[model samples]
Target chain A: MARVVVDVMLKPEILDPQGQAVQRALPRLGFEGVSDVRQGKRFELEVDGPVDDAALARIHELAESFLANTVIENFTVKVEEEKAEAGE
Target chain B: MARVVVDVMLKPEILDPQGQAVQRALPRLGFEGVSDVRQGKRFELEVDGPVDDAALARIHELAESFLANTVIENFTVKVEEEKAEAGE
Candidate 1:
């Protein structure tokens, strides 16, 4: 099976209150040296089969239909096109 | 300033309990058609200045020293080498 990675991030113009809250909590948790933190999200999904245009299209559809909100966020997709070196 | 994006993900050998918990919470939170969710992380950092070997090295160091725990995770870095068309 091929693998796909999707990253979903809030647009720059949008304020990320959740990220800010987490950043605020960090200092009290003993994490210092961080000026700011903007939390975004990532997902690695395995396609049931080979990588092809159809599979890419389907994955894009799934992302839009269920995985993300495009209105406030932007997403990018990457497919594993070749065997990974780490598997060696 | 050049932009850098970092993706931090749990190693495949590691079980993701937090991701499982979030996935379980999704359906009750009104998200349907979602079978699984494995939460990971994304970071987009704007370098205070230009994109150079020194700056790239510094970012990598920060990621290692502060942003992530390397033992259970792996990360990839991408630099914005060209102007984005979206900014047009």
Candidate 2:
């Protein structure tokens, strides 16, 4: 099986409150030197067979239409050679 | 500035409801061929100056302590060569 990874991120122009909260929490926890932070989503998909171009295209369609919010967010798709092993 | 990405994912043994929801929703939308899905979190951090080993270590500490919950999740950290550009 092939492993497909989709990374969904907020548009740069958009403000990310979750990221901001993490940034704020960092300093309070004595972790400094961070300039900014942005939070996003990651999806790992396991497909039943080799990941050919057609499969990639379908995955892209899924990412665009179902996985990500295109209006204020952006996403990227990558296909891995092997399935992600259980327990890392 | 340097860009650091922390990818946080649920442990394989742990069940992912969000991912299951997406998998179930896919076929309904006419998108098929997906076998399974797992959802996770991504964090983009902008740090001031170069990302040397020291910075990476600090980022790791932050990731371990705050960015992810170690009990049920796993995380990986990568230092990007350049900052991600705005808007694609």
Candidate 3:
């Protein structure tokens, strides 16, 4: 099987209250120097076979339509190398 | 400034309802061949200075203590190379 990774993140212009809450708590926890934090989503997909160009295109469409809300977020899709397959 | 990325994922044995929902919706949307799907969180942190060893270590601590629930989730932290800096 082939693995694909998709990272969905909020646009820089969008306000992330969830991330802000974490940023606010950092100082109280004795961690400092982090200027900002943005929280997003990550997805790992295991495809039935080798990932080809068609698979990539389909995955991008999936990312755009289902994974990310383009109005406030952006997403990136990339195929992850299958180390197990490579080692075999 | 430097960017640090932390990815938090559930343990393999744990059930991921969100991912299962997506996987079920895929065929309905005319996308197929994906056997498994796992959903997780991604955090993008902007630190005030260059990312050195101390910075990486701090980021790791932040990830463990705040970003992920250790009982059910696992996380990985990595420093992203500053492309904007290299372009300068």
Candidate 4:
């Protein structure tokens, strides 16, 4: 099985209150030097076979249509590289 | 400035109702061939300077402590590649 990853993020101009809350909490948590933080969504889809161009195109369309709000968000789709099933 | 991306995902064994809802909606939306869908969160952190080993280690700690619930979620942290500021 091939795993496809879709990362959906807000447009650069958009404000992310969720991310802002985390960033604000960071300083209190003793983490420093973080200028900005933006929170987004990630989706993982398991496909039946190899990921070809057509599959990628279809996934991209899916991302744009259902996974992200075009008016305020942008998304990227990529196939995950295979790794050993056991042990990191 | 450097951009660090942290992707937080629920443990595979965890039930993902949100992702399941999307998966069920896909076929109704005219999409097919997706066996499974899992949803997660992505965070983009803009740092003031270069991302070095120490920074990465610190970010990893932050991801563990504040960005993710270790009991149920896993997170990966990476630096974003620089892209042209202009059009894609």
Q: Which candidate gets the maximum DockQ versus the true structure?
A: 2
Per-residue lDDT tens digits for candidate 1, residues B1-88, read: 5667766777777788876775666556654444555668877665555767876766676666556678987777678656342200
In candidate 4, list every pair of residues with a backbone clash. none
Off by over 4 Å in 1: A18-38, A83-88, B18-38, B83-88
Residue A64's lDDT within candidate 4 is: 86
TM-score per model for chain B alone? Answer: 0.68, 0.91, 0.89, 0.91
* Candidate 3 chain A, poorest ten consecutive residues by summed lDDT: A79-88
Predictions: Cα RMSD each: 5.8, 2.3, 4.6, 2.7
Off by over 4 Å in 2: A82-88, B83-88
| A-chain TM-score of every model | 0.71, 0.90, 0.90, 0.90
Between prediction 1 and prediction 2, which has the larger DockQ? 2
Query: What docking class should model 1 receive?
Result: acceptable
Stretch of 10 with least lDDT, candidate 4 chain B: B79-88
lDDT of 2 by residue, A4-80 (tens): 89999999899999999999999999888898999999999988887898888888888988888899999988877
Order of quality (DockQ): 2, 4, 3, 1
Candidate with more favorable, higher DockQ: 1 or 3: 3
TM-score of 1: 0.70
Top-lDDT structure, candidate number: 2
Candidate 3 lands at a TM-score of 0.91
lDDT per residue for candidate 1 within A1-88, as digits (tens), equals 6667767777777898866775566567655434555668887765555768876776676566555687877777777656342200
Fnat of the models, one by one?
A: 0.22, 0.66, 0.64, 0.66
Model 2 lDDT, residue B29, Cα: 95
Give a tens-digit lDDT track for model 3, residues A1-88: 9889888888889999989998889999999888899999999999988899988888988888989888888888878885221000
- By TM-score, highest first, what's the ranking? 2, 4, 3, 1
